[model samples]
Target: MIRALAVVLFALLLAGCSPQVETDQARLCRMALPALMADGAAIDILAETPDPDGRGLAVAFSARPSGPVPERHLAACRFREPGRPRESRDLIGLTLDGEALGEARLFALVRYWLATPEGRAADPAPLGDLTRAPVLSRRAAYALQMALDGLPLAAIYALLAAAYSLIYGLIGRINFAFGELAAAGGYGAAMTALALAGLPPAPLLAAAFVMAAAVALGWGFATARCVFIPLRRARGQQTLVATVGLAIFLQELLRVAQGDRASWMTPVLNQPFALARSGDFVAAATPMTFVASGVALGVALALVVVFRWTRAGREWRAYADDPLGAELLGVSPSATTARAFALSGALAGLAGAIMTASYGAVGYALSATLTLKALAAAVVGGIGSLPGAFLGGLVIGAAEAGWSAVFPIDDRDLAVYALLIVFIALRPSGLLGSRDPVVEGLRQSRS
Candidate 1:
């Protein structure tokens, strides 16, 4: 495992190095450095030449004061000289102990790069040995830093994905408006906290969090009653279209109401949670997260209690199995469907509120995209499985955050869709979707 990891690290290191075909310093001098450095200005490379053909030598590329430095001329500058006495010259040494380089030593190297009559010939030689120490040291430090930072980012993604997976499993469809719900919850809590600016942290946080969660739950109830129930009863392609339309409408309404502006959901308990390995990456759970978690737990507990202990729970299970039969026995399918929608929406709103706090801002136009991602999470985790929805969300969140940190890949939106497609191909029924008996029947019938 260690060897494999070492190989991967080596490959990444090689990738970061300047490509052999074209020198980075040449490009910088011709286009970049001239803009910053006055003519005759010189800078030392902290390390040896990165070029394979011109390794082992300290590189110094400087230009004479004047017009644009031609690319061909810049490229032709010599890298380092060969077989120089590494011990005697002290040409490659750096002062680490706050000891400054004497004027004579600095002038000697500067004059060398200018290649004036005062300095030696600008010969392109591989570095001797002293240059290698700092080069390897700096690279090792950078790689270590990245590895440490990456661990928590990965953990954050896992957490969010798990939360989304739970939501998808229960809802059976992506709540396109889910992100907004989280955003709203977060913003509402933040705003409330701001209103009570002088209050103690505990009470202020509680008040804001409660308001956010309550608002989300209310919205969830309304969506179930006003949008989802009617559409589900219609039980046609129009139902899907209608839900999508509602999502669009909600997003537009929020945009228009807010005048299409950016807003921040400021932190309540602004204290940072520090990690030992990476002191830089500090985060604290927002009030919204606490509210959402409470809501999630309460709902789960309610489901367990109702299902295991109550008459209503047994009837609901029967309804799920056979709606027509349950209705004939006087269990109302309409009521059950309405309840499901309310639950799904409420949880989604809670999540949205949390996101608002996490991001520290919210915008109207982002709702539809949020829904799409939530759906992707649900699908990836296993559609109609609550645990799966939560897991899916975390996976997507982590993947997105992690990729941006380590890679220079573009178009994150495209990556999410690609991931969804791969998941579908690998597990068509989703994480918890049942195998289609009808598909088998059709095959048998055809055979």
Candidate 2:
């Protein structure tokens, strides 16, 4: 396992060093930097946007050159197509301090802007690592930012909820211990990153995520094997009780390992690209959020594909629909349950790694909150419905974000729980739940 992780980390490192791919803002910033530096000017933007006609990108700039007189100017990076490669689009000129320079003049520089003394200066130490592009709008920009914040959260909750749904569908039982399992994954990620403190950020994070997934996968599979499998012949309440006990045990074990304190990893990708701007707020999103969301999306697609097409998935579905019939048809219950639990654990681990990478802190006590939220998400979406779980996560995450944006931040959790309560009270079957969840439960129980 260690060797495999080492290989993965090495690959990530090699990938990172392979090329310099610039995001739109990064590209504009990179182009603007040398020109701004040449004139000893700094940029403060109210808005930056691509041309509606696709000519190039333009940014409103307040240029503060190293002169007694500071001036404001309009700046743009002209390109045939904004999305094309560097060699494709020739920049016309970036005007700084009333001087216009062509791409050749700007591109040919004595020193790289990223390494230069003037370009390196930022308000804070960390902002130096980022490029800024702000779009002006009070409502639209703030909404965009909220979406960015909420999407990552949605991605995380969706992952957990999906795990819940997967296990529930397989065994007709919920693994309440998944939250603890996620925390274990976070611990694994943190410890791995801490151990590899000397590695570059990208490789370090890659290794951490891999470790997190491995740890969670092992624990999840073991939990199913040791705790849930034996209780297969027992009542639902008994399985629930067993898993809850397992949850508590895992939490306490982790807490003891942590010496009752959270372990923190050094921040990775803390610098955000300024996406838009409202009056006192800049809608900022880091690359990490997008990455997390993408992973969730990818996982969701993979799950969908597996469930719809694979023979194992068909067997699992048959077992879920009718256990005795599936068994008679030659499906091995043990093998099916093991694979299902392992996949669920891997999903949990991915969630943990994302949470850690985004927040940079992990604690054992977080297990309960995570588990409860994920459970609520699952219940709200449709306990055994994979698509519903993802949708429910989005609903909860969006609600939390919107509430925090407009209302008091401290009562955010209250709002989330209140929403869950309303869902439970009004639609116990959830948004996309079975037509008769009560009937399904009774049927499963009798069988």
Top-TM-score candidate index: 2
Stretches > 4 Å off in candidate 1: 1-175, 278-316, 436-447
In angstroms, give how far residue 10 of model 2 lies from its true place.
17
Candidate 1: worst-modelled 10 consecutive residues by lDDT: 70-79
lDDT of each: 0.49, 0.75
**TM-score, each model?**
0.55, 0.73
Per-residue lDDT tens digits of candidate 1, residues 25-107? 22212222232245554333222233344322223444444545522112222223321122213233222223434657544
What's the distance in Å from true for residue 97, model 1? Answer: 35
